[model samples]
Target: MLENIREKSQGVTAKVILGLVILTFAFAGIGSYTNSVDTSVAQVNDMKITQSDFDKAYQNQRNRMAQQFGEMFDTLSADANYMANFRSSVLENLINEKLIDFATAELAIRVSDERIKQTIREMPEFQVDGKFDNNRYLALINQAGFYQTSDFRDYLRVEMTRRQLNQALIASEFSLPYEEAQLTGLQNQKRDIRFAQISAEQFKASVEVTEQDINDYYQNNQNRFQNQEKVKVNYIALSVDDIADKVEVTAADLEQYYQQNIAKYQQNEQKRFSHILIEIGDDEAAAKAQITDILTKANSGEDFAVLAEEFSADTFSGENGGDLEWIEPGVMDDAFDEAAFALSSVGSISDVVQTDFGFHIIKLTELKPEQIKDFAEVKDEIQQLVSTQKAEDKFFELQQEMARLSFEFPDSLEDAAGAVGGKVQTSDWLTRFGNTAPFDNAKVLDAAFSDIVVKERLNSDIIEVNDSLALVLRTNEYQAANTKPLAEVSEQIKTMLIAEKATEKAQNIAQELLTAFKAGEDVTAQLAAVNASFEVKNDIARFGAELDNNIAKEAFKLPHPVEGTLSASTVTMNNGDLALLEVSAVKEGEPATNSNFAQQHSQQLAQATYKSFIDALRDQAKITRREVVQSSEQF
Candidate 1:
């Protein structure tokens, strides 16, 4: 069954799957390990899976579900049975990853350092303008919580090794010609079908929906017609941007701010240089001789750019005359930076300078000296900075005051707004599924309908609308959830009850027609008596979309009829209409000769084979689970 499903999932590589897993867990801080918590959740062979790992994985899964389901995610997250099943699935995936890691290590599967470096260089996150940027690469690693480049490289190496192992296993799978032929036939099989719909509308006139029936239905299903709880709120919002224009800064403040944030204003010195390199791979003496010969040519007044373009081994920069373009301090290797920066004048060349990459003959071409802008020159920029800082400070202070005043008053936002020198804003009637401006915010809606604010009529705690904006709201007008009066909903209930009865009648008529059709009796007269007509769709494939989907599905499920006979069944559609279906002829598909069919068949077989192999590996492994503590808190 697993193999059959895999057969349909073509072009899904193991690397793509692992990449998705990494992305899913990235939000849970999967790559960041905490040494403080050492409790084990599970052990695969000698490696122990930590409780922290399980917690992180589970939280990542929850975050994904929350993003997918939005408000409904809260309901599912609170369901104990759903949570139990979710935890089990998370732990199982973690264990499987561990098992794969252990098996790869046991088999000594390895990836080359060059492969790992290439992978990192090609990553879009670490690139700028389609070229690899060293600074961006370092920044991204740090942002992803990796303190060292080697740690990220090690993670990449593990992922690459796992992908290599999976590819090897999948490549070992093959399919027989007969199996491919059979699957091709099955994919193209066709059947000739005829169907007639007995619409609910046909029986609507006969359905008796009395006032008593309507009243009974409305009474029995009052809960379905009840209005959602609603509230109108008065809120005070504070934003940094709104307060920024009101702040003022003087000359002294500008000077003080400039001094405090000198690093942000200071520019780093830059240098432009070109070099001719001789890479020392195995024989250092040979490389030294080669660099000396190049240095002699350079000193003898030969063009440095010409020499670099011909003799430099740094291919990335060599093509551009070894132009390591304009580089700031700390951008290059330490030894290289120092040697190049030591040259004081343009056109000055260094003789046989040595670093990790090679021996280099360096020439300084241009320089830009570092400068700090004077307070008077940057006064406008300083004023903007000071104003933003002051506004943020004031916003925080006012936010705290608003929270305090709202809490003390309990029933109104008037005191809170007055304390902050802001105005109280009122919203329209807002339901759990609210509409309109402020009510559209999920946090605002959740707080508006919460028990403390809606039922007890108290001001909500400060709800953050964004990083710079927050609000405190209180319910001004509240409406309790209640069912509509029966009289108000009786007509709607009457229409619905009539539709239900009509559908029941249509289904019975369809079943009777189907029975008569199979019994070799003509049903044309019967259909005419009910004011129904037959519609025919011919040459429908097993997966064809020509006929109504429900009818097509039921027709294919019926066995092929004997010659000159028919197979009939009754099918119900989404609109409560009944379809009386008859299969007149069945045709087995011939194996397709198209290249697309060949490729699809090949992929399906490979996937099926890979799935079977993995299942076998899982079956052979000895697995165990310890008592897991499921917590509601996000890790």
Candidate 2:
């Protein structure tokens, strides 16, 4: 029952609020956000959201949608209006973040440094053997992109403050006794609904759009018919692979390279071992004492594996009988390496050893002697590596030379192409939106239309398309934005008008049928005329699992029927069809205040209360959005 609450809270707005108020992106640290120069895209009161900040958030959301939906995400991008809404939503999230921060400050919500430290210490990810391990904590945050622990602490402090503010607002909300009873009854109520759908398609055969109607509609919405600016260009696409293809390594060169990196061809002696590690935290004495006890047990033949499993701080190896299999001498700590290699006897236990990590008691299991592969065995692999290295070296040299030559010549890409051992290639007309890549690359597209390329007519400075590829382009043709002639788009306009008329007619017919049903008039003839019949559903809960989404949404908007009166309404379905619904019978489910549904709903109420608070903050704040953000909404 409560799962629906989770489902309801996963929308874009809820997710963004959750992300800003909490670190929901990862276990810790926000996504990588950085800027060299501050250029505000928006401002919430005194708080500014820079272009870098907006780009980071927008790109993060875009990437998340792409990941969640895969190819289906492209459908969202395909619609101009949908894309605009998506961009606006991301901007709104940034605004919400600043607004939330502002509210937190006004409320004087503060998280103490000691409390932040305690929170970090209590996190299970940073703990080893039920105790906080600073090394583990540092490694984890660093891996999560918080290179400095202080930065992670600051982030944690801010999130804690926002959470505190929101929580306080939520806790302040209270439903009175009568209000609670009313809400419980309403929430538990079920409805018996009968709906008749009038398909917009059925009326399309009779719909007509006169030429004059089409012409007038087209004249009024001409901006929608205008074309976007486009450009055709001459470009040199240079890639590391092209240079790699030209790199040649002789047999003698491969032989010399192999000898220089001979250690890579030689396999080091491997040791298999078991160990009991006791992590040294603030209480190093306790860790040392524990290791000593475990060491004594192992030497005394009291089940070494059992001792390791129970006492080891390295939980990963501890679970596997402390086995660290077939590791080279230098694979771990320098002290660990020395202790393991010094043991010559198989099945021999070593004394308690001290290292930077902690104390460890080692039991040598087995060893593999060193071996070297024949030159013939690795010749092919060595040749490929040598060739790649040479190609990379040459590519770097040529990349810089190409950039210099492109700028030096300024007007043409031929010199740059020649310098990089590449050829100038022509491109199909690229829209400002970039119909294809390398034109699709943001930097390439930006330069492709910048005044130097489109107006002054100079070769673009070398732009890296990706890690491997670089590009220099010169405009060959430019298409000025223009509106399509009415003659060309008349049919398209006519079809759209016909569809709109048909939908409106369908809605009117649905309303008439609804009126007839309410007046207790015979509607069998009307139903037959439109080829529609009532669909009855019983015991439909608030979850609306048994009903269509749009139909359910419309059905529930009706006020409860009382004194033998019926509740009726009409809604336009997603497909331009209309659903006329009437609730004939209502039954209330048994209310259990302690149920999961009730608890989840209480949380929902709390969120709703918090939302009101944020809304108030938003209304009171001075919000400003710059042009860079506005122009992006069009795409």
Model 2 stretches astray by more than 4 angstroms: 1-68, 74-216, 266-365, 368-372, 408-411, 414-421, 523-549, 556-563, 585-635
Output the number of the lDDT-best candidate. Answer: 2
TM-score of every candidate: 0.68, 0.61
- In the range 388-431, model 1's lDDT, one tens digit per residue, is 99999999999889888877677678888888888998888877
- Against the reference, the lDDT scores of all candidates come to 0.79, 0.79
* Candidate 2, lDDT over the whole model: 0.79
Per-residue accuracy of model 2 over 396-422 as CA lDDT, tens digit each = 788899888887677678888877778
Q: Using TM-score as the measure, which candidate wins?
A: 1
Candidate 1 accuracy as TM-score: 0.68
